[model samples]
Target: MKLLKTAAVFICLTATGCSSLNHEPSSSSPSTRSAASSEKSWWPFGGKKTAPETAAKIDEAATHAWLDAYEPRLREALKDSKFTLERRDNVLIVTAPVDSSFNPDRPGMLMPTTLGPFSRVAKLVEGDSKTGVLVLGHADTSGQAPVNRQLSQERAQAVAAIFRLSGLRRDRLLLKGVGSDMPRAANDSREGRALNRRVEIVLTPQHTLMALLAQYNTPAKAGPVLAVTQTK
Candidate 1:
């Protein structure tokens, strides 16, 4: 009877130990669970990258906001000058008369009155990482074509130099001399000639409409999406 009782107790202890071993989870299982959780967080099934068009939209919106913020102030500052500031196709066009901004005969000299306007322009466009300046010089039909072109280019270069001195990036300045080629007015009369002999400063965003999309794009978060199950 004593040997049988001892055998029964031994069997009961062995059965209980095996039951606990089967029910308790393995230590490696938690690590596997952790890895799965990490994977789900990083790449959920519903996760999607930001589309190129979306990025472009953000770029457009940001560009517009910056322009709208500065346009009114610019218009107010340049209200009385021969310079006219207008927005066209998402660019700021500053039309300044050559007579007002520079010497009549001196291609490299800027007029005394031009300092004030130049300061205002520099203040508005300088230090903007997203902005670039295109300086175009025009001439009246009074001079030889090649001579006018050279003179116009020199004048444009002169203005661009001032912009460079005003803390603008040298790479952002584009200089061109369209000498009597792109006249806002016909060069027949005195008034028309004055208009034709002018410098046009075009301020454009550094990024193109499509390129901006990527620059300003944001990706969606990879979170789980909830779905309800229908039951009969």
Candidate 2:
């Protein structure tokens, strides 16, 4: 299944004109590019320039490699649960229904079954020191904003405590409770409300060798520069 998915991704990238082997000439000299990069904002990944085509391929390949190592283990661990796992903007997002987390409207009491899933999540985070955890609690629009907000905050704290006990470092954990402000679905329907009342645990790298993979894959602000205007 992994191989099939990978092949499909390759095909999709090719169809969308994102082939790794494609090449384009640089518009400016190395020295000129260097000067421009210096004036740009600083990043941990530094401002080293590579040909756009090559950089795109590197970015795509690196991201694929990363998923290969991370996603499968998570899938195996949480196969029995009705949770959602996905990667977005260079982070792994795991969402669990609030029902699975604790008793209805009870933030202080964590359900016993929730411990296994939380442990698995902790193991994943523990294996990678570069990664950080962000736990966000959300709710449906069933009550006053302030009440919901406090409830969400309490739930987030409870979950973060479990993660810390499960072996994640305290400094690497971030907690937030947005309440009903960020809903996954419309709260009018039962199904939507269920989806909206959830917790999103995000695992992201604090620092990595290629932290700018997304940026490298992005198109330059100047587009494919056909001409470089020189100042006298």
Candidate 3:
């Protein structure tokens, strides 16, 4: 009887220990679980993901005002050269005749007189960090297509180089050669061909001004509204 009682006591103690082990609380706290959940949500391949940057908005009114102030100065500076300045919206377009700007003897070399006007333009634009410049070269349809394209590109590059030398930032200048593809006039007559052969310099507002405008001019989102008709 004593041996049986001892055995029964030992079995009861073993059962109680197993029950206590099963009822023990989890080791992780609420804060620890939250940290783990946050990591899982943000991490991809063990690296945290970041949101992309939003682009800046352009202020049309400010841009146009800037161009308006810029046009007369550019026109006065290039009065002596065979260049014409026209303002369109937020952009100032300066058109230079290739015959007058470049030398006939040297393919892509600019004329000495042309240098003064271009330098003056560079001086005017270089001071304004809000503006960007584009130099486009155009050729008449007189030469072979490939040759004309290459000539136009070289001329555009030469103009950009002059701007860079005259204190303009290289990053702000864009150069392109359109060849005979973008003729201002018909290529059938001599006068028309002369008009076709030209270099166009375009200046407009850059990122900083545009971004400032964007912050203030964001359009408000419209919400749905129910309309009720009145019966008389």
Candidate 4:
């Protein structure tokens, strides 16, 4: 009887040990559960992550087409002046000499004559809700860096104010002051320095407008439509 009882106890202990080894615990610690979940969520073979919806692609062809249509109109509006218009990629850049746009005595203030051209530009762009206007002020390297930057900023602001007063949407206008950083000519000569002192009005199409243009310009059989790459 004693032998049998000892045998039975040993059997029970062995069975309990085997059961524990065969089955995991019913519940795990929070950290262990979280780690397992993370491991299951990751996949090494998955492709690159998608870009955000706001990261639209620009249609180059559409942009160029839009520029083609507006370039002549802009040139006509700014005719017979110190202002020169050029097409750089999709942007229409209207470059105006500082002498024509700003008062010599007050570098930050706009010349009275500058109003007509600026107003004309404002009127042209105001009707197009899909265009954005950038007023950029450039200064020669004659003054202190801080002073030049401030003057440039003020001039840009002055130009932007004119656009606003002429009924351009406030949200569509931006201003920047580049003081002697992007010179059009060598700054060592008087003529070169004069050339560098200028303001540029940059006109760019918004992404929504570009997309529409792409669809309109692209042939139906030309594979996928051009994607909008960037917003205004």
Candidate 4: tens digits of C-alpha lDDT, residues 13-99: 322322211122345332342233212211111232121234356777887788888888888888877788877655777888887
Which segments of model 4 are wrong by more than 4 Å? 1-55, 208-232
Error of 1 at 144 (Å): 1.6
Clashing pairs in 1: 55-213, 56-213
Model 4: weakest 10-residue lDDT segment is: 37-46
Highest-TM-score candidate: 4
Better of 1 and 4 by lDDT: 4
Name the runs in model 3 displaced over 4 angstroms.
1-57, 208-232
What are the Cα lDDT values of the candidates? 0.54, 0.55, 0.58, 0.59
For residues 1-232, could you state the per-residue lDDT of candidate 3 as single tens digits? 6545533433343223222112113442323422332122111112222212444445667866886778788888888677888765446778889888777876576666576687789878898887877676678999976667657756766676656655776445655555676677788999999998888787767553222222212223111101101000
RMSD of 3: 31.5
Off-target runs (Cα >4 Å) in candidate 1 are 1-60, 209-232
Candidate numbers, best TM-score first, in rank order: 4, 3, 2, 1
**Model 2 TM-score on a 0 to 1 scale:** 0.61
**Model 4 residue 46 lDDT score:** 29
| Residue pair clashes in candidate 4 | 56-228, 56-229, 57-228, 57-229, 58-228, 58-229
What is the C-alpha lDDT profile of model 1 across 81-188, one tens digit per residue?
A: 778887764666788777777655654566655656765787677866777666666788898776676566556665665565567764455555555555666678
**Residue 111 displacement in candidate 4 (angstroms):** 1.3
